[model samples]
Target chain A: MKILVIIPAYNEEENIVNTVTTLKEKCPDVDYVIINDCSTDRTEKICEKNGFNYISLPINLGIGGGIQTGYRYAYKNGYDVAVQFDGDGQHNAEYIHDLVKPIEAGEADMVIGSRFIEKKGFQTSSMRRAGIGVLGFVLRICGGGKITDATSGFRATSREVTKFFSANYAQDYPEPESIIAASVSGFKIKEVPVIMNDRTAGVSSISPFKSVYYMIKVTLAILIYRLVGKKWR
Target chain B: MMTDLFRMILLGGVLIYIIVIGVLMKKGKMNLKYSLVWFLTGIVLLICAAFPGIIRSFAKLIGVYSEVNVVFFLGVCFLLIIILSLTSIVSLQSERIRSLTQTQALLEKRVRDLEEKNEVH
Candidate 1:
């Protein structure tokens, strides 16, 4: 339904081509836009070499900014739905359909692919898993866990949501906030079970310290949401 | 009693806010939005503390001297409005920056497309 998949990438020289190529193989008709966020590495050059359609930010705007840019593009180009897939090949291409199913059925405005929904993947370190679990509880309290994956970047949204996010998506660690925002703004949110693979190449952008800060940030943001959210009961 | 409790909390929040904002300014992360809110909040708290009469005076104006409840309620309401207004401003400015960036991107794309069409012609 005029679907656009946005992959926000940084220094994923090893995995960008494979991720883009496989998406082409699996969802040939779907438009995939890779946002190369000022990679000092050859990530942008690789996309150019392969003739992939992409946007290269002049400065590294981070994942949040990159995804927001993608939202703006999808909104301006009149895409009906937008999916965010990681450039690291960690997200499963096959489950993309599942992620978008709720949107297609008109049941949800936002759909996130959860690795922990069924717990079907190589979960990261104990601390990180604990962090995610804590976030899940906080999200649950915020009326956020109707869907399993609160932080999964692998998600799709209907045009209503795409337009909304195109206008205002969070600029950093946005998944949780966006979920809360969508829910509060009266957009139905849901989740699909998907398996996340280990990154086939490159390092994760989030370090342990950042994950800790991220957990705290999302938790506080959720608290703020509960205090002043539209759906606060 | 309720009025006193609310006064204590309000004053404490303002004091902490000033200190935290002072630290932010020291770190060079203080923006106009932040400083403005901080300044206004500081002024409100200082005025309330320095001139405790105003709170009671407002109560008197409303025809209630012993009705200290109104004073506390007014303070809470005032603080809440300030916080909400500050957040709205920050959100609005962020939206502006995003729109400008997107416009710049589209213009760059148009120029590239025009150059390509010229080459083809």
Candidate 2:
């Protein structure tokens, strides 16, 4: 199967090289693209210097739009599957094949790599884990299946789901909202066990002050997707 | 019991508003699509200024005690509508810009790939 790994980087100069190199080393045959999301740092220069395959967006499109661009690229290139691998070092490269297996077997349309599944490797702070718990509960109530890692950026999608996301995607806080959207649209969703590393470089996109706002906004977005009811399909 | 001074001031303000809109349109500063709403608002204000009794009667029908209160309420409603429509326009434009950016980036990658192939050949 033709698989494309999309790495969306935003001011991730500290970790982008490590992330890409690890992926290249771990999965030698898998094609990857680094989406340089108008980074203010030397990220674009680094990609250009390293001769890595990358796309530099003209404007800052945030996380959702950045990943959507990757999906668009994957669709245009006729890839059978597209995997969203984080530009940060948090996500492990070895588990990529595990995430892609279900899609390759034609058993699932989307597969999320969840650290909570095995409760192993960088379990995150207790407070954030509780927040993720609440988000997962809300997602389940909204009929998004039992996704333990509702906010996990490590995931893979089948070609059909990739096409769907390229056409329609939420702009802000898209992870939880997209699961609800896909579930409502009748796409099968699954989760697999994967270990994640704590961020060795660069701060997380979500700050401590913004966690409350993020939770509220993401909850409302999930509920809104449920209420809207399969409009994208 | 409207004062003549107040009525004249209202008429003069409406006239200036219409003239400014006209000037903006002539200078191509305002798009005709968006300026239509402003023009309609100016005309309504003009009608209200030319015939004070209309507002007075409408205010009375709406059970508002003062004509001034009616004007304030209407002004707030119009502002809300206009602001909401502007927000919608911004959302549409941003979506378009996003699509354009993605397309441009993809095309650039394709061109780079083709150039590399030619150099290797």
Candidate 3:
């Protein structure tokens, strides 16, 4: 299959080199592109230095817009499958195959790398875990089920879904929210048992304050979207 | 006659909007606070346009007389504040709306994906 790996990054110059090196070593044949969302840091320079194929936006478009750009590239180039990788090196290359297997087999429209699905060694804070649980409850109410890993960043998509997400992807903390958009547009999704490793270098974008803010904002958004999201569809 | 005709047409359109908002209220499309704002804003603008002379009288009563500069300054300030308020209303929901939509979409897509995987198995 013509697989395309899309890495949406923001100020991860420190971890990106190792991240790309590992992915390349693990899957040499797969095509990969990094969308460097306007970073004031050395992210773009580092990508160029490593000779990795990438697109650098003039201004930071956040996660949603960055991923949409990747989807668009995949759709235009006719990739049979596409995957989203993190710049922080939190995603394990060992699981890339596991994440992509369903899409390659035509079993899943999209496959997510779930940290909680296999109960691997990775651990998050208790407060964050509770926040994810709350979000899980909200998703269940809206979509009629539950996911052990509601906010996993690693995922793969089929050709049909690449076009869909390219046309419409979320920005600013998009992992969990994107599932609903895909579902509404008539795409399939699956979660695989995979381990997400700890970040090798650099800091995570999410903080305690941002987490609370994210929870409140995203919850309100769900209520509002349930009321008016159909207009766009 | 042409001016009157144009005014009537515009008024008809505004009145239609007011009616639509009213129906939305009945359907629970809008809550009490927003409904009140839309209702009052619609009425006030319509009244101001319908009676243009009210502007001069009101301006004079506000102690500006017919002084164009004072009235213009105050009008500009009011317009600026109104624009700022509208922007806030839009931005207040931007991040929240975005996250909510994404989360909801993720849930729906995940189920569909899992079902498809099962089919292949």
Candidate 4:
């Protein structure tokens, strides 16, 4: 399958190159694109110097917009599958195949890489895990399936999903929301076990105080999607 | 009971507001799509100001004790509708802007790739 790995980077100059280099060494044949979200830092310069394939957005659209740009590229370029790999060093490159296998086999429309399924690697903090657990329960009850990791950025989607996301996607903190969108739109989702590493450099955009808001907002977003009863497709 | 001078001031104020909106529309400072709402609002207010008896009867029909309350109610409702419509407009414009940015970035990369291929040849 023609798979495109999308790396959404925002002010990730410290980790972008290493992440891309690791992906190149690990998955040599897979095409990849880095979406530079108008970083105030030198992330774009590093990509240019390395002769990496990237799109530098004119303005910052946050993570959701950056990923949507990648989906658009994949759709327009006739890619059969698109994998979302974080530009930060948190996501391991070796497990990318595990996420894509289901999509390639036509068993699933969207495949999410979950850390909780295997209970391996950096499992995140207890507080964050609790929040993720809450989101998982909410998705299971409302989204009609059990998604162990609703917040996992490491995922692969078939061309149908790539086209859907290219036309419409949530703006900020869209990981959980996108899952809800896919499920309500009648796309089958699957989860595979994958080990994740703690971000080696740079701070996460979500701080301790914001996590509470994130949980509340994401839960409300998922519930609204379930209740809206609109034909998303 | 409003004095004659107060009613005259209200009439003049609404007239001036309508004229200003018309001037803005003519100068292209405001889009016709948006100006139509404001213009209609101004006209409604002008009619109310010109015929105070109309408001008094409507207020009476609605069981409102004071005619001024009717004026305030209509004003608030009009403003609320205008604000809601503006919010929808902004939401649509932002979506369009995002799509434009993504397309522009993709096209720029395609051009760069073509240029590099020419250079290699």
Candidate 5:
């Protein structure tokens, strides 16, 4: 199967090289693309210097848009499966194969590499964990299946799901919202336990001040998707 | 009762608003399609100022005590509509921009790959 790993990077100069290097070393056979999201820092320069496969967006498309671009690339290149790996070094590259296995076997259309299943790795803070719990409950009520880590960015998509995302993706707070979208569209969703690390470098995208807004936005997005998401045959 | 002075002032304001919109359209700062709404708003205000009785009667029909209050109500409603339309326009533009950026990035990568291949040859 032709698999593509998409690393969406924005101002991730500190962690970009390490993330890409680890992925290359761990998954030598997998093709990867680094989406340099119009960073103000030296992310693009680093990608160019290291000869990493990267795409520099002309404008900042935010996290959701950046990942959608990756899906678009994957679809255009005829990739059978695509995996989203964070550029912040929080996601492990070793579990990529595990993430893709369900999709390859046609058991699931999307496989989320969840950190809460085994309750291993960085479990995040209590406050954030509570928020994620609430989101998980909301997803369950919305018929989005039992997603343990609703905010896990580590996920793999089958070609059909990848195409769906390329055509329609939430611009803000996409992680939880997308699961609802896929489920409503009648796509199989599964989760596998995976270990993650605390981001070693660079600041997190979600700040404390934004967390409240993030929670409300994601919850609403989930409900909205449930209401409007149409099943694709 | 609408005072003559207030009527003159309202007329002047409406004219100035229309003129400003015309200038913006001429300078290409605003699309004519978008400016049409503003123009229609200006003309409606012009009609209301020219014949204050229209607003007075409408205010009575709506059970508003004052004609000025009716004007304010209409103004608020119009502003809300314009703001909502502006937001929709922004959403459409951003979506288009995202599509364009993705296409451009993919094309750039393909060109770079072709160039690299030529170099290897």
Candidate 6:
């Protein structure tokens, strides 16, 4: 099965080389592309220096838009599956095959690399954990599925979902909301246990100060999607 | 008939607003889609100034206590609607920009690949 790993990056110059090298070593069979979300730093220079396959956006489209760009490319290129691997060095490239296996087997339309299924390795901060728990509960009730890691960015999608996401995707705070959207639209989602590492370089865009706001916004987005999301036949 | 001073002032104000919108449109400072709304608003204001009795009767019909109150209420509502429309416009513009950026990047990559193939040839 043809697979594409989509690395959505913004201002991640420090970690970009390590992340790409790790992917090259670990997931050589999988074709990968980096969507540089108009990083102000030297990320584009690094990508060019490495001769990595990358797309440097003229404007910063944020994470959601960057990932969607990858989806669009995957859809156009006729990739059977597209996996979102974070560029912040938190997500492991080694788990890419595991994330894509369910989709490859036709057992699921999407597979999420979940940290909480086995509850091993860098579970994030306590406050964020609580927020994720709350989101999990809400998704279960509204989306009619048990998502252990609603906010996990390490996920894979089949061609059907890749095309769908290319057309319409949630913007800011997209991870949790996207799950709800997929569920409501009658897509099967599965989570696999995967260990994640702490980001070795660069501060996260979502600061501790914004965690509360993030929680509130993502929760509201999920709920709103439940109301407005269209069900597929 | 309303007082001459009030009528003249309202007429002049509405005329000035229309002129400003026209100038903005001519200067390409405003999108036609958005300027249409403001143009309609200016026309409505002009109509109201031309015939205060229309507003008065409409106010009485709507059970507004005073004609002036109806005018103020209508003004506030128009402003709110304009703000809402502006937000919608902004959202659409951002969406378009995102699509353009993604398409541009994809095309650039394709061009680079083709150039590399040509060099090899």
Scored by lDDT, the top model is: 5
Worst 10 residues of 4 chain A by lDDT: A224-233
* TM-score of model 6 (first chain only): 0.98
lDDT of 6 by residue, A1-233 (tens): 99999999999999999999999999889999999999999999999989999988988888999999999999999999999999989999889999999998999999999999999999998878888899999999895499989889999999998988998899898899889878888899999999999989999888888888888888888888899888753
Give the TM-score, chain B only, in order for the candidates.
0.58, 0.92, 0.46, 0.94, 0.94, 0.84
Number of colliding residue pairs in each model: 0, 0, 19, 0, 0, 0
TM-score, chain B, predicted structure 5: 0.94
Tens digits of per-residue lDDT, candidate 6, B1-121, equal: 3566877888999899999998998999988978988887878778778889899898889998777777677778888889999999889989999899989989998998899799999
In model 1 chain A, the worst 10-residue window by lDDT is: A224-233
| iRMSD in angstroms, per model | 2.2, 0.6, 10.4, 0.6, 0.8, 0.7
Residues A1-233, model 5: lDDT tens digits: 99999999999999999999889999999999999899999999999999999988988989999999999999999999999999999999999999999999999999999989999989999999999999999999999899899999999999999999999988888899889988998899999999999999989989999999999989988887788778866
Predict model 6's lDDT versus the native.
0.90
Candidate 4 lDDT tens digits, A105-220: 89999999999999999999998999999999999999648998889999999999999999788887899999988889999999999999999899988899989888889888
Chain B only: TM-score of model 4 = 0.94
lDDT score for candidate 1 against the true structure = 0.79
Model 3: per-residue Cα lDDT over A182-204, one tens digit each: 66565678888887777788888
Clashing pairs in 6: none
Q: Which segments of candidate 4 are over 4 A away from where they belong?
A: B1-3
Q: Candidate 5 regions off by >4 Å?
A: none
Where model 1 places Cα greater than 4 Å from the true spot, the runs are A229-233, B1-95, B113-121
Write down the lDDT of every candidate, Cα atoms only: 0.79, 0.91, 0.74, 0.90, 0.92, 0.90
Candidate ordering by lDDT (highest first): 5, 2, 4, 6, 1, 3
User: 1 or 2: which has the higher DockQ?
Assistant: 2
Off by over 4 Å in 6: B1-4
- Candidate 5: docking tier: medium
The total of clashing pairs for model 1 equals 0
True interface contacts reproduced, per candidate:
0.05, 0.71, 0.00, 0.71, 0.76, 0.81
In the range B17-88, model 3's lDDT, one tens digit per residue, is 789999999999987765675676567556644764665577667776553344345446656665776688
